[model samples]
Target: MRHAHKRCEDDGNWFVHPVTNKAWSNYTTCVDKDDLNFRHKINKLYISGYSVSVIALTISLAIFCYFRSLKCTRITIHKNLFISFIINNVLWIVWYTTVIRYPAVLFSNKPACQILHVLVHYFLLSNYMWMFCEGLYLHTLLVRAFVAEDKTMKWFYILGWGCPTVVIITYASVRSSYPEETILTPDSHQTRKAVRATLILIPLLGLHYIIIPFRPEPGSPEEVVYEPISAAAASFQGLCVSLLFCYFNGEVVALLKKKWNQVFTSWKN
Candidate 1:
């Protein structure tokens, strides 16, 4: 495959590989192939990370939902957030196993494929919105500790779930107006601060390159050398949320201790 890009001499369009002198007629083939390979590697890592989060979130949800004593406004919010994580992670796994592995399916414009694409992104955005809800809930608790409002969760449900729909619908509407596969100009891509931040800072583990087989997309002018950084970050949701909201939870620890003591006492009897 590496030598498939060797110069044809009939057309000198492709930039020659310095070391191998490989230059194929359709340079974008190698680039797209590399892109596909990169996503494949990220899928493995996503599965591992997302699987851990699903386990943690499952435990967290079970503990909170099963125990009546753990019921509180904050815990309610946490449960909802964990639900979002569950959905987001599952959707991402579905995406990687199906769409990412078979990107041409996206080009097919199949109703199911298009719906899956929308759903994966919708839940992804919903996950972020739920995180915002967590932050907002925490802030509300701190700033308005005395102000007891029973309808707080109601409004939160609206903000967390409702707002993401508006944004996604607007996105779909705008995108539907445009042609398929519209590549962003260099300047446009540069202005994407969120994307830039994810690409630069999120993959701190530096594991993307290690997992991905070396398949350079040198022919692609728009493809970054480390594009997998953004993809990995985008796909690897829920793990941090699970760790923060469940594993390190003092309340959950106390509940576990209480339950353990109850079981031990029964056994002694």
Candidate 2:
């Protein structure tokens, strides 16, 4: 969905609601009506954005996988980045088509949905972790060219895949303690978003800020207002990474051009 709150314990403001539920309920129409509109918006904007991202990401992945010469440490990490986005997009698509579209399943709260819920965020955290790895690799290679690439990649793997589990476990543990309807179960949207932002920022300077999700009223159905920060951050991940790591990369572009020319020359022959 275009809604950022879907994946997290809750990205639904997705943790950045400027208005309280008491105020929200005052002006908003029927709860079901608002939720319906939200669902429609999510399916339209989120699905379309993610679809385009998936196509672009596939092309980016192919560029790296097909070219043996371009398989350097940096580019390998780029492939991992693309792979993370790919998995995230695919799982989200599965969520939309399978669980969400079928209202009965969503409200039924099937075990599969819970698994999907966990998986969706897991891969998302994985994406951030790998991006952190990307920055780390860059810094290491630039400052110390003598370091062994394999060792560096090994460490990257452990951190990128391992770290998110801690967050997810903490999230699930905290969420489990509360009743299902409680808003606190899912951490605040901005809190989760800031965590991802912090990962990208931590290496730059020593500055750190811990922002958590802004929880809504305990039982207010209308508390789930969508926020652009979490929504845009989560939905547009594939597009951002593709542009940053693959589409905009000098090496990837050159390789793609070389492949196109080779294909064109073969066609002419």
Candidate 3:
């Protein structure tokens, strides 16, 4: 996909599109059959990645919910983060399967599609916000030896869910005033065994956004490497987070093992 921009005039007005005769911030670039096929493949990878993430997140969520012993401030925060990711992934899956897959649905510019567009971004923002809450909570715990869990949790709830609502409302209100524009937009190593795990997992967790602004020019040699890396980072982020925080967690692993052994011994008896 290409990113085309309209330059603002010196008088603070905007440049208009020649075809639509309306002020536009961005416009889509036309692509050939080869590019279109490439995009289809990328989008399929996205669907598959997101589907796997959703399944992993759902199972993680269930594990956290089922084990009453796992209840704590940290696990509570993890639950909310998992929830945000779950909703975000489900919405994205819907979007790719419906809006992106069907040119008619995308171009028809219906109200439902527009609503879906807003919902997708809203949850996307929530994903980051909840992540921020996670970091904040960790910092607070480390810095303040006796931090109040209830109070911190209240703020976390507001930041994780409420802040995104405010942002999306402002964005939607402003965007509603404009004409609809078409959608267009726009990794690395490890030590031996440890290095290989880091290389594979870091992108999956979407940590590659640290260099988002450094995107190479379209069709450049760098883009050849950038595209698939970016796609994997964005698509598999939820799965990676769940694996690290849930499935790979020592406490969670211990609880699951104990429960499994209990059930097995009971059945044997």
Candidate 4:
């Protein structure tokens, strides 16, 4: 497919191939020949469902945040989970509506695209980091129930704000080594490597789950009872697992199917 901003003429109004010096008409055909009907229907379904979910989650978080009394309870770790959920949903909404819809802008405008790209990556990393923190906090409460009530506010701030910042800084540092000309090509092997790395890194959530449950605590009535930490750990673990299934595994399978179909069609033609 031709680039959206392909230079045409020296005067800069025409579509010209830089390599071939071939001038093309201003009017270009759509890259995908599929009818807009199915695409539009899919887009509507995605936007409506995602928007509703994000709104509901955000409202729930706001209500919880406003009630400071509720935040003091052992169950407040769930509030952290709620906050993480809201942030992630917001990221998804922005990603789909802005970034995904403007692929050309992302590729053509380097500075703006890089900023958006970094922000997107930062939040995506933050979502998982916060989930890992949630699991850690939950496990701590389960094993050390009394301590869960002590210094809850301090730990809450640390986990919610501190961890994401650290992760973002680390990512930015690593990304800084690469040149600005690093464009992701369609057949890039680095894509697979990055995916593999992410998958390996995300499972570190389970380590938090394991560590929290190992902390020492006195055997008391509160200790015997299921703590909020355990619940949060379980909830976050379940979420991580489900997301892996739906987002990674399912999406990969669908992508493979689409690629295979395209290959078969090309061979037939």
Q: What lDDT would candidate 2 get against the real structure?
A: 0.67
Clashes of 1: 1
Q: Alpha carbon lDDT of residue 110, candidate 1? A: 69
Please report, in order, the local distance difference test score of every candidate based on alpha carbons. Answer: 0.65, 0.67, 0.81, 0.53
Tens digit of lDDT per residue, candidate 4, span 178-229? 7444301313363454355345445635555564656446434453333344
Each model's TM-score?
Answer: 0.67, 0.65, 0.79, 0.51
Candidate 3 residues 193-251, lDDT tens each? 33433444445444679867898887678876787777788888888889988898778
lDDT of 2 by residue, 117-224 (tens): 888888888887887777677556444546777667878777777788888888777766763632012235634533554464453222211211563453355344
Model 1: which ten-residue window has the lowest total lDDT? 182-191
Off by over 4 Å in 3: 1-31, 181-206
Clashing pairs in 3: 190-195, 191-195
Residues 1-269, model 1: lDDT tens digits: 54334354556465664434555254455556765675567668777767777777788788888789878876787788888878878877777778777756655666687677677777777776776676665555444545454677888888878888898888777866773642012243433532443343234223343645655565564345454554545444455555555666666788888899999999999
TM-score ranking from best candidate downward: 3, 1, 2, 4
Best by lDDT: 3
